[model samples]
Target: MSNIMETSDNEILFIVKSTPGNRQREPTESDPVVSTLHNRKVYKGDTTILAAEFSAKSSVIIEWKKNDFTIYKESPQYHAGQSILIINNVQHCHHKKKYSVSVTDSKGRRVSSSSKMKVRRDSGSKISSSSSSDSDE
Candidate 1:
């Protein structure tokens, strides 16, 4: 017995084949598996994106969180799954912040991945001072 699963060009394909005397169960909805989430560094006032990728047998729900608090999609910072989490005009307050992405499959199985954001102050923003004094000639 052989089975082929149809998938979109952007989706991964899985093929299963079984021989006589060897029975293989058909695929079913499974938990989403996190594929990637990497730490990112960006300069203050710049934009940064935290992307998350997953693999599952069925559709899944994606959610983003910061410091364990859910980040609503209505917020301008959220750009949905395509970008996962987009931070515009990053600030020092966001430095060392932890961001996570959770994916839940139809079966209720869920998985998560997290990454930290490192914000660096722009060199041009640094303040420098110089003083010069001359004695009476």
Candidate 2:
């Protein structure tokens, strides 16, 4: 018996000999499996938190990206993300933006999950109410 698996641009093949009372063994270092990032909705200027849970046999590196662009850890808006990513002061520019998180294990196997941000205007804000009135004039 044989089976093939794909991970991070690499393929792995497994071959098993059929025998009486023989059982398949578990893999020692399986690729990291990550959780989905659910889409979020927040008022402008609010804080947002995005998290991706993963399981791996070895330590892993976590990275975050926005709209396919890398979001550096040094960015003011970016907080820690061993598994959780925080973005503070969400603005209009963040509306509809796609955010992704990648997890890479020691073996260089990587997987990613993404979610979109929906930023909404704060209806209670005076500035938003005044802007709507002005636009109608």
Candidate 3:
């Protein structure tokens, strides 16, 4: 932290407003200091659906807000051309939002993607899956 010399009342107030990094104002005599803000990964905009091939079907759990939307919860059976898309309906989630998708391996670990997508409106487009055998010449 750096010390500030009292310039003017307005300038000093502006400096207080522009503090860098995480912030939690000192508590008043009766109240405890509180900083409830968290930095969470966010996606913006309508997402796209793409074609993919899955060896087996598993439940897809989405954690947004206080709700979790699921697919094939009781029965994890996803077939070819299955859709996976995110609609931008959540607050602060901009259009064509970016999400960090975690695909797990059989070992129960996650695999992250290094790329992001700029997609179309959720309901306007659909994502499907496709599979084929690998080929080598």
Best by lDDT: 2
- Looking at model 2, residue 55 earns an lDDT score of 57
RMSD, every candidate, angstroms? 18.3, 17.7, 22.8
Model 1 CA RMSD to the hidden true structure, in angstroms = 18.3
User: How well does candidate 1 score on lDDT at residue 1?
Assistant: 32
User: TM-score: which candidate is best?
Assistant: 2
**Local distance difference test, per candidate?**
0.48, 0.51, 0.23
> For all candidates, what are the clash counts?
0, 0, 16
Q: Rank the candidates by lDDT, best first.
A: 2, 1, 3
* lDDT string, candidate 3, 1-137, tens digits: 22222222212111111112221243232322212112122222322222211221222221111121221111122211121222322223232223332333333433222213333233422222112121111
Off by more than 4 A, model 3? 1-47, 50-53, 56-75, 78-83, 86-93, 114-137
Using alpha carbons, what is the TM-score of model 2? Answer: 0.58
> How does each model score on TM-score?
0.57, 0.58, 0.26
